[model samples]
Target: LIKITYPGLLLEEILSTIAGNCLLCVTKLDFSAPKSLE
Candidate 1:
């Protein structure tokens, strides 16, 4: 296994940032999808 350190973006910060970005993308997609497709 390999280990590394992030002085700026810690593990929790990275995870939450990714989750937040995904949530935003999902919400936008939800808003963009056509009603006929639902």
Candidate 2:
């Protein structure tokens, strides 16, 4: 069971990191290019 749980924890950690990066990118883009297409 340890082996099975280890991968699950690792996957969760990776997913959270990716989500955080995506949020940061979106926020940065919005701030940098607000109303540019207008």
Which candidate leads the pack in TM-score? 2
Q: Candidate 1 lDDT, tens digit per residue, 1-38? A: 12256545567788889999999999988888866487
TM-score of 1: 0.64
Report how far residue 9 has shifted in candidate 2, in Å. Answer: 0.6
- The Cα error of candidate 1 at residue 4, in Å, is 9.4
On a 0 to 100 scale, what is the lDDT of residue 24 in model 1? 100
Tens digits of lDDT, candidate 2, 1-38: 86476998878888999999999999988987866765
lDDT by candidate, in order shown: 0.77, 0.87
The per-prediction tally of clashing pairs is 0, 0
Estimated TM-score for each candidate: 0.64, 0.71
